[model samples]
Target: MSGGAQADTAGRHGFTPRARLGLTLIAGGAVANIYYNQPLLGLLVGEFGERAALWVPTASLVGYGLGILGLVPLGDTLSRRSLIIGQTLGLAVALLAAALSPNLACLALSSLVIGILASAAQQAVPFAAELAPDATRGSVVGQVMTGLLTGILLARTASGLVGAQYGWRAVFFAAAVVALGMTGIAAATLPKIPQTRPLRYRALMLSILHLVRSQPVLRRSSLSQGLLFASFNAFWATLALLVEAPPFNLTAAGAGMFGVIGVAGAFVAPLSGRFTDRRGPRPMVVAGALFVVAAFAVLWAGGAWSLIAVGLGVLLIDIGLNAALIANQTRVYALVPSARGRINTVLFTVMFVFGAFGAFAGSQAFLMAGWSGVCAVGILLAGAGFLVNVLEPRGA
Candidate 1:
């Protein structure tokens, strides 16, 4: 299906196959930029050594956080299509830089730039929300998010396969080509929607802070999503260590296969969105939190058993994480129609910052207390998410 036709179907608020394909491609491209660094980390360490490799992913996370705070709000002030196209061009350049970097420091610095420009994905989500009709907004967002999650989960496997066959540099080169193609497609197919108001960059940033402080629904939803994502990040960040150990004794390629298992969550994302649209985000949010907690319990139980059990835990974690994410996004989008970009910026920025922290803490936990420590941390964070929901306004 052509991108424009699919977008038009979404614009009409009906489920069209073309619309699904278009949004999925857009979302996949956007999210892939953020995750392509994961499987490359080991390859990077082999070339650049441990210290620099450790810092490289952190640089990307930092860049992502900064992009959420600085670049995403521009979606409110500028045309989203233009913003996405511009960022896509920047991402292409950054990918090329990453591909050509001679040293660890250069790669790490380039990764930061890649991440900042990759905020295009963040812009894409709100754009999806804007394009979707009110009746199906949640479901549409869910469908788009499925693509995003698929990109994130599958990136590890894709990168590993490609890197193994053609070397690490090839991965970035492929990414650059994809970025360029996506940029052209987005520029041609995306509708030119006007912003609600013309606000100065300074004003837009200020408005984002105000929204965070003033909107009760936004505050609760953001916090809930933030904590949930923290747990999600923690689980994935530490998964390799667990799989590499005695019981599993898996190679990196085997570890990468777990990503394919996690793809189950993408299929579940649209269902979560439909539920959110019908029942409101509250029930989904609550249920999602419980599911995450259950995933941790399953991981704990699977310690001495089959690796299949661990794979099941990963699947549950992905499903719960994606469901909570869509539900929170649906609620936040409902709270501020005029400033979708700014609201999304705040939401994603907070969640990613927590994700970064979770990555760090998970590493520490793994080093200090093994899988049990990782499970403890994940469950505690999930519990905090439950508490956030409990404290939410009764009707909200």
Candidate 2:
């Protein structure tokens, strides 16, 4: 059934197939907004000049980080369906502004707003967790995240294609259209879920700290995922550069196409969720971390080998990164029922911060030691993530 048809019935139980699919689509689109500008950076630079390279990506990421910190916490204190639909409209406006931007500065500012509104995606994630039954929570998160990861990967491809055929601004224009369409779908289909916690915004924000101090599982899960995500970010930050240089000498379009290959990871997400449901989240987490370590090894070696090897490395890293993400999130959401929003805020805040740093670090590493250096850093991070899981406190 379509999301509109099942909205009323699934609104009560949260596990309806159509509802899950709807939430997944929303999550993906929301996340995609933040990434749509990446593949178009060269076009942005060509239009806006060299300064665009320095600030455009940074503005979006900083805005996204701020959005996660400031806006995502509201999930626990507001009507989620209303909040999500409203934010999608906000994102659409921002995308429109970006498309119409007259100068680099204008585009940068609009991109920042785009990032801020994109936190709406984070809301869908925790909502999916909260709505699912305990026995299949892992599976549900996995399915929802498959959409999120798929969006993250595909945003580049879509942007690259649209920007190449039209112009960079057309990417934003297309995104605006999609956001508006999604807003309508969400407004009609998503259940109107009331606040789980009625605390004032200040208190609710402060409570994230208290929850962090108290929950060892939350701490471990956050740390494990943070490290793994950092590794994942590092690989992506330098991937285009690596593929465009030396023997292969591909264009930005070629780099963006890699997103399609990475879809393999998204395909495995639901299967990982099922595995987490059957065995515990910990094993999948371990498996994910180990997959990262192996992926980095392949990447490091592939730096001197063939493009085929590097593509394999990309596929493996995405799979490992997303699998661990689903498992970590499944465990974290289960820690507190009413507090899922705050917990998610904390989790993603840490992950995003680390991911930002990873992008910067990867750039520096690639500049210094090329792809080999990038792979080394990823290996260490992924290995640390695995070790953290191994050393987790018995109860945690």
Candidate 3:
């Protein structure tokens, strides 16, 4: 089926404010599962010791990347409502397992399942796209993404506070409860949309490549976001470690305080979306990347000397990344309206694969070169993204 026909089949049914809020909640709640471990790494290190703790965050993120590649494509073939609900339920189960884990190995394994099921967030993003009017689509996407980003930052704060007060396992238990509650909300509120044209499962998978080959905007937007995401992940993956070490000497809970500061930046997503609706996404992409470059400069200069500077850098980084993300997503969703699910899958899969790399690189960079090294890596990645934004064909 052509993208246009598929979009036409998805008849517009007044996406009211209530539905938008519901989608924001669902997306936020689902994506939060994949990030709950970042700030808790220090606590995990205390509980399981460093050797085992070091790999837990990476394991969950790698699992999320795998899920995006493997399960998200199914959105184009399956019932999205059923798929989203099933994944949310699975996430609750995984979180419960993590909460009850007897050892780091068990918890790490459970984290992987948590990550895989968390691809439910991917389905929700495109589903929101399908429901909105064409004129306001970018704004709707931005609002949904705002929820997703807010969830990510809040997960850290919740985990840090919960882990500090009740122990690391309590964080997972809390997450499990949240997931179960979100499942009920999703089941009650989400509308049923009929499936698109049925292709054989193998053919459905291969069409991802066909979409990539045919769409220049998807390729450029995906690559641009991937590079910027690498930098974003690089900072976040090591944030707990950096703050927990020498001059800062903060606990796991303390590391999580930064997440609260990051939340302030998330307000930009909706605004960026509105702006993109008026100004176009490319300009925002360029401006956002420049913000990231400035953020890294702050980190490099203030790594050891000023907590205030580092905090400002964190805020800037979040603002920059969220802006670029909203812009890129706006571009991709417009490219092939009917294929939003597949387009999001391809875009995010590429972005998160690089995210996994960024996480790995952040850890290694911290071990070898310290905070200065980490900032350097972030600067290079964001700079590369800016160059791509400038050089890519404007028509694309």
Candidate 1 has a TM-score of: 0.91
At residue 314, what lDDT does model 3 achieve?
92
| Preferred candidate (lDDT higher): 1 or 3 | 3
Error of 3 at 389 (Å): 1.2
Q: Return the candidate ranking by TM-score, descending.
A: 2, 1, 3
Write model 3 residue lDDT over 1-396, tens digit each, in one string. 555655554536535676678789989999898888876777788779896566788778878877888787787777777888899988999999998988988988998999889988888888778777777777888899989888887877777667768887888888888888888877777777776576687887788899999998899888888888999889988987878887889976677688889888898998898889998999999999999999999999996667798899999998998999999998898887767888988899888778878878877888899989899899988999899999987566
What's each prediction's TM-score? 0.91, 0.93, 0.90
User: After best superposition, candidate 1 residue 201: deviation in angstroms?
Assistant: 0.9
Q: Rate the local accuracy (lDDT) of all candidates.
A: 0.82, 0.85, 0.84
> Per-residue lDDT tens digits of candidate 2, residues 250-272?
97777778789899988788888
Model 1, residue 32: what's the lDDT? Answer: 80
**Residue 105 error for model 3, in Å?**
4.5
Q: Which of candidates 2 and 3 is the stronger one according to TM-score?
A: 2
Q: Could you say which candidate leads in lDDT?
A: 2
Candidate 2 C-alpha error for residue 187, in Å: 1.6
Instruction: Report the number of the highest-TM-score candidate.
Output: 2
